[model samples]
Target: MDRFGDGLVFVVALVLIGWWIWRRFDNWLHEPPSSRLRKLAQAGEVEPDEAVDFLQEHGYSVLSGKHRVPLGVIVDDGPVQTTRLYFDYFAAKEDRYYLVRLERSRQPIDWTASGLRERLLPYALLFPECDGIIVADPKDRLLRTVRFRVEDEKA
Candidate 1:
């Protein structure tokens, strides 16, 4: 009787494990494709973009340009407003992906810590996989990379 009970338990355990594996496999198979990074990587362009050239000159390899992600914001539980999070260029250096944002004359960047957090932190938070963000000012020839680190504080 004990032998039969052990066999039954073993069979049940196997069935549970198989069910969990199937669930994982099904989710993986039906998961949505990755964002534009894959598509841009696949597209081989003969013509070089100016932004790409700028990045290359600064020692970074440009992967793609004009990357945008659709964003929806709801304020005060009101209707959702659609906008875009625009990335001027995507580049790599030292095997790390960096999202590039070109500085515009009209909307100058605030170099202060608070201003930097308000303006640029969203990009880093949205793509936690990315190493950081590179802000390039072609006119003034400035290239800056920003990274965020969170440390636990002992209270």
Candidate 2:
């Protein structure tokens, strides 16, 4: 009887593990780029202050790194919900707002899963509100904009 109970427990554990793996895989596929970049910025691998300085030197007036504002729209079964979008740094110059992403090179140098467009499109949706979205690689001393055109928010 003990042997049977152990076998049942093992099978149940295996099923649970498999389910968890599936959920993780789904997240990896659908997780937006902005979220990944935000995580990287928060990881402390690269100093936020350094990135802020870089943006400043390049003519970006850094406003704040984090803030919640009623900015985007989300449609659901219930009702249209206004979602607050997050950016690493919100900046402006000449009365223009831009959502900035500060990426500190943590890995050796690779773009396997994380690509540029995946992250930029979401920020672009803030069109008219924000002039555009810019991504900064402080370690590389490079800055680039993700030009926004109409596109789906998910992959």
Candidate 3:
């Protein structure tokens, strides 16, 4: 019966391994792009908060203030909650509002305008009233302003 017990043990081990692999794949599939961006910034390649501050220092007024304050509206005797919004920067003289998002990598050359555009599109939808969005790579001091195109869905 020793052989029979060994076979059963192997089967249980295989099942455990399969479960672990499946869990990892499931997590990877559901991971958000923001998580990847944060990892890049944490590697000492970029400063995301600094970029936001730069925008504010340049005269951009944050709509909901820092740290995304929760604004609620009462409906049906319950609070309707919405996300707190913050602007990266705004230029009052030019009537421009900027949403600054950061991207970073150890190999700065890999960074591209298209990649930045892909990340900022969601923010544009979130802040439809903003004049523009700035995808800033603080490590490289590279900033690209994507003009808000309310007419274009891609923006």
Q: For model 1, how does the per-residue alpha-carbon lDDT over 29-130 read when each residue is reduced to its tens digit?
A: 886544444554444442486666778997898876776678999999999999998777777788777888999999988999888898999998887777
Candidate 1: list runs displaced more than 4 Å.
Answer: 1-47, 152-155
**TM-score ranking, high to low:** 1, 2, 3
- Judging by TM-score against the true structure, name the best candidate: 1
Enumerate residue pairs that collide in model 2.
Answer: none
Q: Once model 1 is optimally superposed onto the true structure by TM-score, how far is the C-alpha of residue 16 displaced, in angstroms?
A: 21
Candidate 1 colliding pairs:
none
Q: TM-score of the candidate numbered 1? A: 0.69
Q: Considering summed lDDT, which 10 consecutive residues are worst modelled in model 2?
A: 37-46
Put down candidate 2 lDDT per residue, 1-155, tens digits, no spaces: 99999999999999999999999999999986555434433433323578888998999877667644466455676667676755677777776667777665562323332455565565665444566777788878998765555658896
lDDT, candidates in the order shown: 0.81, 0.67, 0.55
What TM-score would every model get versus the actual structure?
A: 0.69, 0.47, 0.36
List model 3 lDDT by residue over 1-155, tens digit each: 99999999999999999999999999999996555433322333223466655555655543322223245667788877565544333332254444554454742323465764565666677656555766567656666667645465785
lDDT of 2: 0.67
Model 1: ten consecutive residues of lowest lDDT? 38-47
Candidate 3: global Cα-lDDT?
0.55
